[model samples]
Target: MKSKLNLGLLLVAFVCVLACGPKKENNETETADTTAVSNEPKEFGEADGKKVSLYTLKNSHGVEAHITNYGGIITSLMVPDKTGKLEDVVLGYDNLADYQKDSPYFGALIGRYGNRIAKGKFTLDGEEYTLAVNNGVNTLHGGKKGFDKVVWDAEKITTDEGEGLKLNYVSPDMEEGYPGELKVEVTYVLTDDNSLKIDYTATTDKKTIVNLTNHSYFNLTGGVKGDILGHEVMINADKFVPIDSTLIPEGQLESVDGTPFDFREPTAIGARIGEDNQQLTYGGGYDHCWVLNADGEGMTKAASVYEPKSGRLMEIFTTEPGLQFYSGNFLDGSLTGKGGVAYKYRWGIALETEHYPDSPNQPDFPSVELNPGETYHTSTTYKFSTK
Candidate 1:
């Protein structure tokens, strides 16, 4: 009977081991799933008394985008290079405090009128409205507190193509001197094809001007250790909007032919950036808007950048009419970015797709007026590939 009892005890122990072994296997599978595609958001910090979270979105191709809802900012984007090695292709801070303290927009979303309005003044419906002037002599990027500064409500979504983060924010009437109760929804999707697609939709209760865009500073080299001067750029634009000394558009579109602004062909950013051009001097570098050539009205190829060393290529497609290519001219090594790297001049570049700058003030430009019954919608995609 004692032998029989020992046999039964051994069987029970074996059963327990079998049970625990599957649990470990299950845990391993869960970890693999999380690494492949995860929607779980970790607490980033508190912003404006509200809890902020950081979301990790990974695609089938292992492209990961870490986005925080504080400013709907993409803190880091890991993309694969020519060697199938992944690296962060965007510039941003490692922590929330750094971003909140000071940021050059980084990977945040811009809204309520991107670029600038001349002198922060725009007359809508015969009523002159004055906005908070942040840039010199103009209201830039939605003025003092643009969408980049506000916290947005975020929701994890599963798109048919890949993972998505849907962000929503409401701008009250007369907020930032804008005349509207604007409700904005922006969705960011990381596709399996290695594309970061942004979809924007907004509606307002009152007539207000609206222009939204993402301001992600990109360095195809995968980090801020080097500058983007060697990257070849090709903008599908025949005309470009020349800016004044204040960096506001001159309200007239000029042909890029025979000018340094000509990027109809693949050209290095530093090739003509130092040419004796007044526009270059005014903006300190290439901070002008290019008039994108359209082939219908839907999304068209706006611009492309290729880094030969890494064999990384990024193609921009947008439904907007204009594309602002701003070389990182403002960075002066005053701020330290990810990995304790100092952000220097021309370390990164911004390719912002939107309507023309100061659109509300420029009647000749595209109208940015959003009526109560009309809906504002735009989409931009930055597709990445290797040579």
Candidate 2:
């Protein structure tokens, strides 16, 4: 009877161990999967009869970004708030069809020339070049078929910092009345530190003009919960480029002191937005470029925004010379964005880092020319945190 009891006890102990072993293993696997970084690509439909794909990048911290090779647009960016909840912060549409239809450069890569060119024409090396006039009487955002409307080749890559998506496009000479066959490469890396870093590099076979920037409409209230008028903004600029009634730079830099353009300190976006000012009326809101302060250069802090409701803070750093602060004055309720939300006036803000608008026309402005054997390179970073 004692030998039989000992055998039964041994069997019971073995069964318990087997049952508990697998449960512990499964829990460990689940944890690993949750924290792992991933770069996933899915078909986003086609543009110009070419297959386009959307790439989703996630960092170890669970921050996510969705980008499409169709115009290298950032369709969605998920960030964490003070409560540790992730929410989409940028404005965009749900599908590729909406983006291709009537997007006002939403989360897109702007190129060739970022802002406006006076009268849709410029003289380059004793030769006259005419671009497509889309914005009033000026050439806006590279022309009708800008970089934001084309398909790019994309590849997922991993670096020591984090996972990245590399997008490449080759603009033929005079594709949109531009000069050179420009080979452009842009890489977006979602770092573990909760920053989206964009690095742009371009080389041209012929001497041509080049200015590139990303237009990501941001509403830090987590998916346009409300308008961005209440957000506090601070731009490190002492002077700004004033625009004419046509929204083209007047070829002169005016001091921001005592003007509504003075964002040297943190102030609410709508504090003086309704003031009786000519520049304000000309732009319909804040759609001008701010010349960054001279604080050493390369990768300096360009601007910072704080949203009180969500306790979200976004800081922008760039190597560019100018920052365009667009108050989204043109975002009427005509277009519906992600989650079927209608984007209204002042619903978003765009901080575009680049050279001054119409640099080709304003000879005094920083040159946007790229000669043969010379490479054009720039970097911008959008860092997020909870204050």
Candidate 3:
């Protein structure tokens, strides 16, 4: 009887071990030496007669992000809240066709020139070039068929930094009225430290201009939540570019001192957003670019956001010289996003890191010109946490 009991006890113990043992095999490579690529990639949709794919990128932490090769867009980003509950923070549509349709940039990658160029025209090397006038008189986000509207070649990548996807696209000479055959590669990595890192690289055969950035509208409390005006925002910028009637920079920087543009201190986005100010009136809200005050360059902290209710915090660090803090002023009630939620005005906010808008036209600004021999490289990381 005692021998039989011992055998039964051993069997029960073995069952428990099988059920509760560590799940390390799924996330095996925790160190730098091994490749830890996440599995499970699916076909997203077809675009321009090509099959697009969505890749799942997971860190050792519970964080996961879904990115599709079409436009190199992030379909969803799941991160943990203060209570250890994972939730999607970035805003987008549930359908792939909606993304390819009338939606805003959402989680798409912006490029060639991320922000606006003055009057859809610029004189590069004393040669004037004309581009598609999409946004009023200026060219916004690369033009009508910008980098955000095309397909990219994506491959699973695992570096010492983290596991993610490497998306490559080659822009033919003057594809969007921009010169040079631009070969570009962008890598999206979700590190174990609860951060999403974006590495951008490009090389041009001829002299061309480039300012690449990701346009992910974030709402820390989740996309389906209400307006983000209650969220606290702090940007390390002492100066901001003022806009004109058409939302193009006037080629000047104004001190943020004593103005609503001052985000030097953590303040509610709506605290002074409605102030009777000229800049606010011109932008219809906070839509202009702010010159960031970084400590001697090379990926310094640019901005940080905190959602009081969810206790979610996101910190932005980048090598770019300027940050565009848009308050989603144009998100009217005309469309619905993920989970059938209407995206109203001020529903999301974008903290886009890049060179100053119209950098090619503003000679005083940091040059966006990429010559044949020069390589264009920049990176930005968004770190998340909970208080």
Candidate 4:
């Protein structure tokens, strides 16, 4: 079933009601609605009574990104191909007003753990901790008020690599039932080579676990229309973690050699997405985490995606060992997006570079432990170009 948000009809009704008002003499306070539609920001008051600044990044090739302090969201990412036509490849709202209310994670940083926890419960050192359960029966993306919902502290930094932006946020001790006062720093650098390098660093006063990733729903065809099912994708993975109905890994490393999870060879995203596979049915589409063919440290190629229509290609490089490929199966057309367009199923894809989901719960999975006096450092680079 498809649905649409009738905001346009409501706006027309509002204008009609205003037109019936008595015409009065000129009054300073009664000017324009002031909230009239404009690309400019519409402030719905302050958080801590402080102004939040939005930042933009443009390269010599004219590629740019609009990022804001709130949730460190990527408002837009404009890139051009061989034809020199610019298009925003990221799916997002028109302004901060929509972002502050309801949003589907969108292009925001996710943390203290990027995926899920079983029943919002986990044990560490013989102690059990129950977290905020926001996703059905499980704890998803940290919780209801995860990092994606917070106003991160933003800073612009210039490095030899290129122009960069850093977002810093501190997770208090026992916050979200996670131990330690964890300090996190996420740096996003747009290099001259058209590579978006994200560097993550963190430290904790006590023992704590952390896995961070960006939740940017991408559609290389500019995200204006259509589904990403036709895009050819390839992930350098030989293994994938199988999940249960709750989308939590079952502590088993399954080989992708004979399954649809095999992306070692290029294949259309929708080629086997609709198969009567148990995992696909549970997720409603592809939302599994593949164990990347990386050394689990340093920089390495994780995955690559190509859209033939736009000749746009994206390569995912990361220091992490897992990549979560999410087909936008949950997007229902109820919310109006940028330019008043309704987003539909498979309208975007999110390639989240992070550790395997529920790593802390699985002893065999890669360790996400960040202990005292040790720094947690990781980086991922998304290089864009034309095929």
Off by over 4 Å in 4: 1-45
Candidate 3: residue 206 lDDT (0-100):
93
TM-score of each: 0.95, 0.91, 0.90, 0.87
Model 2, span 1-387: residue lDDT tens:
999999999999999999999999999998887655334588889999999999988898999999999999999999999998999999999999999999999999998889899999998899999999998889999999999999999999998889899999999999889999999999999999999999999999999999999999999999799899999999999999999999988889999999999989999999999999999999999999999985675788999999999999999999999999999999999999999999999999999999999999999998999999999999999999999
Q: Please, what's the RMSD in Å of model 1?
A: 2.1
Give the alpha carbon lDDT tens digit for every residue of 1-387 in model 3. Answer: 999999999999998887666555434445423443337568788999998888988888879999999888987999888898899999898878999878689999997889999888888788998988898889999999999999999999888878889999999999889999999999999999999999999999999899999999999996558899999999999999988888888888999999999999999999999999988998889998999998885888999999998999999999999999999999997888889888899989999999999888888898899999989999999999999
lDDT of 2 at 26: 97
Candidate 3 lDDT for residue 335: 83
Arranged by lDDT with the best first, the candidates are 2, 1, 3, 4
* Residue 201, candidate 2: C-alpha displacement in angstroms: 0.6
Candidate 4 lDDT tens digits, 6-123? 7777778888777655444234235544423332433433444556667766667877777777777787888876587989898989877788777888998888989888888888
Question: Candidate 4: deviation at residue 348, Å?
Answer: 0.4
Q: Note the clash tally of each candidate.
A: 0, 0, 0, 0
Q: Tell me the deviation in Å of residue 221 in model 3.
A: 0.7
List the global CA lDDT of all models: 0.93, 0.94, 0.90, 0.84
Minimum summed lDDT over a 10-residue window in model 2 is located at: 32-41
- Model 1: per-residue lDDT, tens digit, 1-387? 999999999999999999999999999999999865646798888989999999988898889999999889999999988999899999999899999898999999998888988999999889999899999888989988999989999999999989999999999999999998999999999999999999999999999999999999999998765999999999999999988889888889999999999999999999989999899999898999999998878999999999999989999999999999999999999989999999899999999999999888888998899999999999999999999
For TM-score, the strongest prediction is 1
Residues forming the 10-long window of minimal summed lDDT in candidate 1: 34-43
